[model samples]
Target: MNESKPLVEGAHFPLALSRPDLIPAARYSDPDFFALERDHLWTRTWQMACRLEEIPRVGDWVEYECLGRSVLVARVGEEELRGYHNACRHRGTQLGVGRGHSPNGFTCPFHGWCWNLDGSNRAVFAPEVFDPALLEPEALRLAEVRVETWGGCAWINFDDRAPPLRASLEPFATYHDALGVDRMHAESWFETIVPANWKLVAEAFMEGYHAEQTHPQLLARSAKSGYSAGTDPLGFVDPEDIVGSSLYFMRTLSEGMGGGMVHARDIEVAEELVRMDLPDDPVEALSEWTTRLNDEIRSRASAEGADMPDLNALLSSGHIHSVNFCFPHFWYLPVYGNAASYRIRPISPEETRFEVWTTTLWPAGDQASTPREPTRRPHDDPNWGEVLRQDFANLPRLQRGVRSPGFDAMRLARGVEGTIANFHQALDGFLAEREHADLLPALHGVSGPIDAPIRDLGL
Candidate 1:
């Protein structure tokens, strides 16, 4: 539990913060609030810049852009990474556009000012053309941005005073580490521009309450046996049938998402599970099946020399949350040694860039190949899979609906939508510029996986 504290006692503009269950509707559509986030929230929080695999070799770099600012993250050595403001010191020219290699370090195209991968001043186009004092080492070195690596991704923070990445992540890091998340790498990556605020788009995936409504196919397929037999009001006519239904659920979930949630190998394990004899009672059978499924998945992956975790132990300890929300703008849903992830960034008050990646564990002792640049597509592109397409359909509608004159605020469900509330509360702490000591507790309360009711956020 977190200590309750009033972090936004005097906040006047956003009326929603006064109530725990309500979110200001204008926060999604108002330019003023968005600017506040640009100046306060984005500048201080740790955010995923790029997957480590994207820059496998030295001199490789990826430019991460958010709220009009750009950061260039580079691989300076086999185990070293560095980030710099993506602007040249001379005339403020932008340094890099996208991901690429610059073996000779970054050279400003405008005037040929150069900085090494370590951010030291390498050369200036014409030393005699400027004041010698201006060409000093401190003046010419690239402005540094804080860079840290975790979960196989490079994260950047603009504020030098911000806490270390791991310290800020807390139980979120502990949970992911238990699941072997750092060993997983991107198998596929894609991106699309969404017609909504970044927060609205991210909130869409923060809970399972919408599963039955928004993703009816998933619910229907997974629950077919529960309501299949008309004669059995309780849907327990045949206990043995539960095995078949469970198999179908896994199969359909994997197929519907186009291999986003469960990997092909997981489906194979499910197929194998149905061949075994099981208990006659449905509850007992399900219990046995779940235990075996988790164990077998880990065993099979480990047999192939892939780094795998003790899934049964993790499940018993309640370490698996299905969907983990890294505060502000990142999420990863890991299942059976495979996972799907999301990274969201604001493009404007009403537009956002959303990216998705499917990740899986690689064989131990072998480095995973570099993931190709994400393929950008329209928000409604079929290639995003049926589940995501269905989720995307609601984003534009929600964005437009929030602006209605009659709509007062977004009333969040106390239990199911707790993560959404947690997000806003943490954002308020930043926007209010609370002291680090005062804000750290609230950050810890909101920095882990979701699927549970709201906890005391110390705010």
Candidate 2:
């Protein structure tokens, strides 16, 4: 059996030698930088449009708008899904607003020209009113965009030459495949508008370095090694005793920078539900818990005639939370069968539409009967929890602080913030107008290790 490799394992992270240790303050608050991203990055990457369940039925559609560009994804048949630019061929009117069933097709509210679910022209109200050549079916049809579905989500790419989504998301896709995120369903969903640069909001969750300050409650555990210099030591008195406590146990197993553990608020709260009482053997308890949980799920699935993988096998090998940033704007954090996702849409240099989505494996015999529309909430919404709220509040302040005359750049902690630094290197490559094929090498200062697994994975 192949042992699972830790996500942040050494020899996997590359250093861009020429890259500055200090990230420019302007990158976070400069409108010009944001514009460069809109023009070069967002326009060329594969972006998550909607969950497949959101448009499960034929004719059901969802519209995704980002960086002043809008796309419409629709299901045209039981297995057919397609995407198009969300504008009418006629007077440049929008074909769909938000989301709904348009079984017959989309009709332009402005001119009544209609488009079929396949984006083909169905009828033009006044065809003779224009030249015959201009009224050709191809000319009148909605401009089609590339769309693909994987892991229960529909992804769209505006660039015609963009590589397949799976290729762009390699090794991470391997993790998502094992967890079967495609089989999971949304448990709760919401988006919050944060008054901060998108990059500022994204970088906040990329590392656990901030837990000692941003989320002090997480390290409030009585465990001695709960908090280290700036990172969590994750050293418990009894390794076996750690299994029962939520944060302590999971943090014990969820490896991060320098082989130390990292803690996030969701993981902290999740740990609370499990018994924290002392165990005879912490390691054995964790092993048993994983075995029993996997068995229970398998049994339930069999009884319900549903299908589920034996994730215990996968988890045992090395199932740390996988943090994957699908470049330009999407971030996915998948742990076991549950995931929390973030999508950052830039409205301007200082404003962004930050979306947070959570999904978990659906229990056998239970499924939502209706599609869910995302709920928009303020940063302080009680539903987001105190820890999450704390992170949200810190972001805007960070944005403001970066703008201070005294602040020139950011000093990144390479061990803890390697991923963030790698991201900036990738961003610089894009801003320099390099192709994706050549861009990733910038992560290694020039070219990364030829056999480096993460070199192509785009971390």
Candidate 3:
């Protein structure tokens, strides 16, 4: 097989994905690999802890726990957010549980020690009994974790040396900033415990190649594939094989496979879809409809004296789908009218928590109808919708298949699965950070970076 040029070519994803070694199946099941990931990927990266709206009032706090580590994000003042390790200084007791408003700040139940909302040591009982020199109140302050806010959400990082949130997430922040993300509300939020590795759950959404086989209902709106046979053996149409620019369209900034024009004479459209206000051609009709809908939304938001950004600019520029895979655990799929985002966290080597949040712009008046705080439920819950259910149904099977002795590694379809390859390559970059350092002395006589050797060998 010939190797295709890496779509996301850079220091982030250095591996040539055509090589089979890029798929390290053990990373999905091995406890030792999981431990290494917990040490490097989880701790050294910034995580989206909670939305700013979730803790709107002063003294309100949300406990974000993952992989045996916990953090408490609290609103100490009107606009100030702070994060702490969630453990008391005395006897190492958890400071808070779940979400609540602590007016007088958090008081440890195990001991009488209290920490102020600002994470300062407030008071400890029996202070006189302990030596003041040995027990300085200043030394007993809650350990603080770095906290920052962007796109109306609070992010926490355990590593003090980690770069600022904006710096760490460059083009992603730039892309999301174009759309009025701060102005959008969390229309719906849901979470579920999936019985699959965290990586397996995340990879499901990174590519659209599985849509035809997994979500055949989506083809009803496609004019090109209107009851037509797909080209590939999997009975799914490959976007890169036809339609749109292979390099920049779907791979970088544009919409996914079905962005082309819709067929008017196609027989696949359902009776309900055919009778709708859409035009004769459904695909172009959907695009035009999306533009008109955004125009109406802009007018309504203006009429209601609400501040909303012009998302139509993205549509015009062909930067319509700002699909970004923020490293470690977040996926932001921001479109012109509707947006969906996902977060995955590991509960163990086998179970992971998957979070789905859908966002839309609504006039300020619609705030009353905004969905409630996200509640965790099973994936089969009716509220998850059909497409999501279909996507999740394959995760456990993937987990089981990857562990089989017959399957050594995955042969990635580089043409269509480039995004997934980029993800795996980036993950390898993270895992190789320290391993490459140990080889520096071996190349004392050699010059330049040491990664060239590793990348060439497909390591």
Q: Specify the poorest-scoring 10-residue window by lDDT in model 1.
A: 229-238
Worst 10 residues of 2 by lDDT: 446-455
- Expressed as tens digits, the lDDT of each residue in 1-459 for candidate 2 is 012332222212222123434576778887777787788778877788888889988999999998878998999999999899988887798888999999998999997988888888988886878888788777777888899887778999888886777776555566567777788766556788888898888777767778778766555343544433322214334533344344443554332211112223324444543553434554555455455545654555446554556767776666545556655566567654556666778888898888766665535235444236778898767666555777897987898999999997788775666666666666655555566666433433312111112122232
Backbone clash pairs for candidate 1 read: none
Off by over 4 Å in 3: 1-21, 220-293, 364-372, 434-459
TM-score of each: 0.93, 0.81, 0.77
* Per-candidate alpha-carbon RMSD to the true structure: 3.8, 8.2, 9.1
lDDT of 2 at 190: 71
Per residue, candidate 3 scores C-alpha lDDT tens digits across 73-157 of 9999999999999888888999898888996799999978998898888888888888788577678888899999987789999
Alpha carbon lDDT at 435, candidate 2: 68
User: Per the 3 Å backbone cut-off, how many clashing residue pairs does candidate 1 have?
Assistant: 0
Candidate ranking (TM-score, best to worst): 1, 2, 3
Once superposed on the true structure, which residue ranges of model 1 sit more than 4 Å away at CA? 1-7, 14-16, 220-225, 228-239, 362-370
- Rate residue 135 of model 3 by lDDT: 73
- Tens-digit lDDT string for candidate 1 (199-242): 89988988888887887666422144456431222354344566
